[model samples]
Target: MTTSLRSTLDFLLYDWLQAESVTSRERFVDHSRDTFDAVLDICERIAREKYAPFNRTVDTQEPHFDGEKVTLPQCTHDAQKAYAASGMLSAAQDYDIGGMQLPYTVEAAANSFFAAASVSIGSGLLTVGNANLLMVHGTELQKKVFALNEFSGRFSGTMCLSEPQAGSSLSDVATRAVPDGEGFEADPLGPRYRLKGNKMWISAGEHELTDNIIHLVLAKIPGPDGKLVPGTKGISLFIVPKKLVDTEGNLTGVRNDVALAGLNHKLGWRGTTNTLLNFGEGKYPVGGEAGAVGYLVGQPGKGLHCMFHMMNEARIGVGMAATMLGLAGYYASLDYARNRPQGRPVQGPKAAAGAAPAVVKDAAQPQVRIIEHADVKRMLLAQKAYGEGALALNLYCARLVDEMHTGEAALADDARMLLEVLTPIAKSWPSEWCLEANSLAIQIHGGYGYTRDFPVEQYWRDNRLNMIHEGTHGIQAMDLLGRKVLMEGGRGLTLLASRINATIERAIQVPALAAHANALGAALQQVGAATKAAWATGQPADALANAVPYMQAFGHTVLAWIWLDVASAALASDADQAQPSTAGRMGAMRYFFHYELPKIGAWLQVVSSRDDTCAAFPEESF
Candidate 1:
């Protein structure tokens, strides 16, 4: 809850995004800027009071599981409770479901405080996302029994997608679900089924933080041939609870066959329990059966579609986590720079060339704060650019989510198209560059930064996971180039370019941002050209061989657009010119334009040429 963070959030929310305008919508009629401020105030206070102080405690004291149950520190428990009590878990849900009916944009802004304070202690990302999906796809009873309870915080939720064998390839998933018995269809819950399989890398898979854990699992139902259907087409979603619960949502005192096989010992996020879960292992069978009882969600073979509702939300959540972690490191390093005095500026005295009439060489000079050094400022500016630019980018996407849900039909459709193009970048860009921000944070701390004695090292380790989770960098790359940009007859990409061009036009009117705007216009053109050239052959292998590089180039271009837009907005709003908030944003924007935006050339080069040097390498040559 640094004042710096709060101010940045304020500027982004009210000034740049014009979040207050969203309250005019009928869905958000209950909310006002005052109410939004109160929510943010409470969130900042709770995060500072309960989460910030115990960040180190949770990191050092990992979750442990005894023979019978898993255990976590009391601080983690208290923090989770405090966050749930804030009514943010269902912030965007309807008022009927215990939600305050807050706008998603404000919800994302409020959640950032907790993420910055401590990401590993849990942020209700999965719980909220899971409930949101059920609200869309689940039946009436399912919504009442699971989604509502989750929103109330009586039951926490998780999305179980990856298997040990499948990993990110949902097409290769092998988890199987079968009808429970003769009366399975007539059972009060949707279509009752029995599931038996192993799910890997389940976060918060087994925890006592709530009354029960509701798992939204992806599995394939067997065909009449008694064989599991092949590929993602066969995939279907199921709701499998940790403890058997009735339609009224009361625990039946009988446990489902889902068992925690073991915990993953990770380098970071030690506070969360990432586990290998064994379903239907006979260890906790229900009613003289070994298979875990699950209720079907949506139609058979439509599980991936339903599960995507949660996956996409989690991807955005991961992006915000990465952005906040990077900001956390930036804040830490910025504080150190302000307080730690070590060096004298070299510009103090310039002796005449070859002149002996100068001050004594041994004269003692006072050491100045590290902030006095230009190189240190470079590092700080880089962090600020990446971290703050990413914050704006993510919040912009959140704002789009609001528009998509609450805006008129045409505006909502356009928002959807823009989201399809931006989601991967929003998720992957921060994951990669923000981790670099973390690295620079450590560099600013010097040798002590890498040690456990400093918190920057831990921020680096925690952020390293963002690139691999939700979706891998490579997976997102393929999604961006292989699918997203080309979806809907390339309308999504065109919609995005139109928006970027709109920002460019606005910024061109501002003299300070004119050059940056022109530079961004060129970058966007390069991205567009590379995209067309990559697909010139109309072959997946040729186009996708350089997908990662293309994604890198595309993400940088989008960020450049975001920076120019922010700068343009600040100038338009007539912000106090002398304020550090305004001046620092200009500086960070300048840094990105001069130092970072040019690197996209090399990335787009390989992309446009469809370079296959790596793809063609022989296995033994490595």
Candidate 2:
């Protein structure tokens, strides 16, 4: 079996995780290095032995539904079952739920392996994690009804946010929830109102893999005045089940009210089910013998807020998954490069004195590995920067999660605020950049990358879904610039800037990193200036128009900070390693600063401009 490139990246991440524990002094609830490594080892073994071997087969023999039942490749089912039985599905949950309850950071690291192995198969596990999150925040009765079933792997869960009309705009969602006759006693805890609507693009919405599916749906509840409550204020979250539950909280059978209308054949991630669902199909009795059964989560008007809880977690998952896919492609390309011999350098002279030049077929000597080429190295470096950098960023956030939960209260507050500010970037930037890495991996493979014969192409397809997953790049941009940065009088943004400045101050003292430190400081100031000017205008839309540039600016700035931290830590470690490798460490640091850090200047320029090119175009231009 070929060793995974992702595993090597995870090894690096494991080192970072340990460093974070020492530096942050926060013990993670779910994972430590030992536990994380063991899980990753298991994932690596399973991914190589079980999943990777079947990836192409699963892709060719995609899941199929014949009117009544859906059938997937046996290998796909086996892989899914093996992953579930390994207790990986509950990584983010507490141990009481039959889970290892690994830390999100550790789980994120492990997921990289699975996604790299087979993105489509890996998605099933992600949906399970998503369901578990909702169950944690859900009511006790809801837990008994939904969470318990999920724990048993009897019911898979999906987040249903998009509609045919409301893509990213939740406020525009037209799905309606009406009060029924005292609600239905599907579970003894309490009855719930009937939910009737059409939800589109629901992942795992209607699949035969599990006995039931729990959909966390968003819909508008009627107010006392009868009109839709203003905007999202009228919106509420509901737990809509594919089958009605008994008073004993047992899923009896399929309920006709919720029917699978159609399946969406997507560009990629094909092993997972995506369905168009029609509620209130009028075929079976629902809540109080009415329409579809729906239970309210959190509060009536606070549905959108509740959804954000899951959305944030999902966003990080998206980033991690995308990064993993790219890492997989990178590893495959690297392996192929190292082993595949092609033409020699054109600059080299022919072999001397009757020796044959390196050539193919019956006439020649052995050729050099493709990896020796400079262009191949360039692609590898780009992949490393994006994939490894994203890994560092996500793991850093996970460490913050630990700090938020276990550190001193004051420190926890600061960590939480800083994490909140970085969340969008942590989620969106990697999805964008690592997908680029996947694309580069394909390029490295040349023509083979375009065919199923090479996994890099599949990696590209899988990563493409990430652009629309959790949230789109545009949505994330708006959230970062319009809300998180400006929220609470820029408290989050200030906290983040303070942290970056602290690193900048430290790097400034190091001769090797001093210049990049100065550049990052200047970039931070430019970002602050741009932010202030946007806010000063008091036009949120204009501020949002510049959101994409702001994301790029802030992403690079934070990445520089992270790179500096890593370089400093590496240099310090080299000094302590007895047999010092300070020179090599210094070279890597210099390469990053001189070659990578300068890009921040260009990013800052665009951000500071506050250009309204997006707004300048009229709606009719197209």
Candidate 3:
């Protein structure tokens, strides 16, 4: 599994994305191919030794809270510490803060190993994202007290969003953050406040992996009338620590007013703790108060905007996690198909004159490997197409992150626009398709797939959570069709089309890729037309009615373009050295184009016509 993944990473990083070229930029000048390889080597080794061996251990053992503290397996603690020691928590940060200043592209690829090894064991996505958000919007002192410690792994972080009542509807959040005291504005760590609310489904919400858990909470600050403001615009980000910390980053030796309400027993990702947490419930009040003390991150009422910095990063991370799980399933199933021989091939009645024979074999022959069967091959290919294609898409988004930060003016502008257009697709497409890959993997495992004895069923369960978290498929669809495509008056979508067309132009020059190039070109056209048609009446209600289908069609078109781009690159890849992996990619690309691309048309039909069958149906009928 590691070998296959390593080879794929090599091809994606060097051959396709040209990660080495980023070294030309001043931010990454200290790095090179050697430094990147060293990091990758460390991550892959740690993942294999510390994570892969313990995948089942953590899953079966799970995390248990015994009222006082959460008890995780010893192996989980070992893995978490090892990950923190890896410097990956700050791999993309500056050199001054104990970072390698590596490009996000390399960082993302390096992290995939750990995710594939065990998706359940935490990998610092929330911590890194939390710190990164602070670096962008935090004050100098706040950065020192909070973000820096998070990057150093002395502290872990989580974003507290969905409340039990609000769930996905931020506008309905009831969490309130009022000024802590009269001198709150004078405090060094930004404005201080006392928060009272309950957050639900918080991952890594309660853990002993780090010295402190800095929760970036979202809450509403009341207006002058002492009434909590409504909607997301009123939402604000806060830094609520599990334990209070002073200016010098020393532990204040006092627990915050935060209390763990209960643990959520999830179907998957059990290694990480999910909790219902209560703030300001008088559990452990500070200074005789009944509220959780928190420091403001940005301006009040702009909390969602600030939290979005972390949320967007998390969305991409979620996409990568989904891709790795799908790949893990694919690898497990592939191994089973190769060695577990099944029934012999059934021969045809007879071949017609001058016609090809379907099979030239006898029933009395030895049973062949399941891989020899075309149906199994089809399932394997679909998994490959979905998993690898999703990986490439996520990595491409990461590459854009590098460009957005380091490229020249015009290039950075283009990268920024393209990223906005692709983020939803990047998050949702893998979550939707790669899940199917897991299902196919289970199907290939036959009866064993259903039982817990095999890992494939676990992979499916683990992946099932991806679509619902980070933003559900429905949310992403609305964001894409209702907002992303129409963002900046469709400027982002236009930038995306330009990039896709450039790939089409390049792939069309190659004989073997021309057909796919044409198909993708048509797909791009269909999606563009559907985007316009959906909103032709300029009524958001009608336009977003079939948003999920539009998103599905758009995501498929984007993926088709990605596969074509990869296949075009594979043409120039080393013919002998990369023959096997390269051939596999080529086959996967073909599978995507042949079997997956056409399905977009049916999905797009609803979008183009603004079909209202589902939306128009009365809820009472159900």
Candidate 4:
């Protein structure tokens, strides 16, 4: 069975947010469930028809480099073109910019469909994120010349932060951007510069899919003495297009100095190109210069600051992508379980004491479907919990983005703090847990899951990349414990606690959820204690030694709170009817609390004790 992005989105938009009256006022005016459903329906149709069919083809053929040009499946272009024309690219932007002005929550839901259908074709995510960053920080000319074209799909965008030498350590970025004297254009897109550097691991970096590629490159501006400054403090953002364009959004037909050096082959997500690009190798010099022409974005020496907006957005997008992949695998496995007959009840009549009953193609006593087994049911339930729970977490974070944009001062501040605290978990939890859900998906398919015949293996392969997407698991953990949770004098953590407490309080009002609520309450207390103990160690190294465990414990508590809220919402919708769907939700809620919440205690114990087993171990000892 195909995954119903529509049904899930409808429930989330109408049953949860509409019931909560979250997006009733402000920029969301004239937006109703019908409108949201209409947009999602379009996304579903396009994704199913254009994208899903070619997923495996893209994975198999991948992108080929013929030395001079990169070749991709025509289907990839068709899918992306369809997506671009859907108008969903600017779905969350203001109407003034040819956008739908839809709430971020609705937009995110619509995008989830595409991500689930084919993450390979879902390369538009980076373009959207890049345009969003420019919309926020780009000059008016930059918005018109670059961001607008991106919104209209005439141009594509990429974020260039990683270099061959720098890797994730942005502080060591060695790219240099020098002020252009003769090559400067007196156009509106911003100040012109000459970028001379090489960028590596640039996805969607060099593509023939669009007229031009707008690169939001991070490079350091040289000092007055022509010496390159060190570290990210000297880093600045630049709009270095693949082909230089005129102010009227027309390509000047002057090819920039950005050259596609080579392609990086990967295990998955191969539909999009990953490239090593040389900026100024004296290859394609423009205007009698040997450097790539670029325009400064925002301010010089503050590139990382502006890039964070895009990075954070990309982090959340990664979580959503992970959740959708898990959900897709879950549905596929579920269909397999319901039809793939494998075994009979272990205790049912003992197979009539026969020697395996001479297994035949069509035996009189046909085996029952695998889903009938308790263990298989447990796996399904586990997938359901992780998949749906991760979806809820992602949508919640998206809603917070909406609130931060549209809410009142105090409410917006609260939303920002809560989002900040949850960002790491939002990015990391789903990447870890949902990938585990995908593993269960493979296991559900048994032997066939390991083969190319099944999609489950591909799902697992695609999801494995997310654990390292944006940031690795360890990086997110450190950020959560060492930075975000402790920032602003712990106001973010305090705000998050209050919100979780609100959910717990609401859950306590429902007798069905009271026990889970109490469990969550106790777990929250342990998290609080763990937080204090981890910090009280005084030794930053020791306190952070078990940061990953701290992240897990904290992540579980957050998910527990989310489940409680979800259970409350489900029950709320069927308070008197006691529908089966509601009952199923309650069952999953119980499963999570019973099976998942208890694991947090041991994790938190290790965290709170400030264990330094890994930190103290000598690398040579290994």
TM-score of 4: 0.95
lDDT of 3 by residue, 450-564 (tens): 9988999988889999999989999999999888888889999999899899999988888788999999999999998888899999999999999899888999999999998
Candidate 1 structure quality by residue, lDDT tens digits, 185-220: 998878899999999999999989999999999999
Total clashing pairs in model 4: 0
TM-score per model over all chains: 0.97, 0.89, 0.98, 0.95
In Å, residue 102's CA in model 1 sits off its true spot by: 0.6
Query: Per-residue error at 153 for model 4, in Å?
Result: 0.4
Query: Which portions of model 4 miss their true places by more than 4 Å?
Result: 1-3, 19-23, 182-187, 348-365, 576-578
Output the worst ten-in-a-row residue range by lDDT, candidate 3. 572-581
CA lDDT of every candidate: 0.92, 0.73, 0.92, 0.87
Tens digit of lDDT per residue, candidate 2, span 506-585?
88898867887898788788888888876766877767777776787788777777777776766555554443334533
lDDT by residue (1-622, candidate 4, tens digit) is: 3445566666666777662364467777777767877887888889889988988998998888887778888998898799889998889888888999988888888888888988876747888989999998998888998999999999999999999997888988888888788646564667788888889988888777888899999999889998878777899999999988888889988999999999998888878899999987768899777999889888889999999999999999999999999998999999999999886655433356555644434445669999998989899888888888889899999989888988998999899999999999999999999999999999999999999998999999999989886888998998999999899999998998888899988889888889999999999999999989998957778778999999999999999998889888887888863676677677778889989999998999889888878888899999
Residue pairs of candidate 3 with colliding backbone atoms: 236-303
Window of ten residues with lowest summed lDDT in model 2 = 22-31
Ranked by lDDT from best down, the candidates are 3, 1, 4, 2
lDDT of 1 at 523: 93
Better of 2 and 3 by lDDT: 3
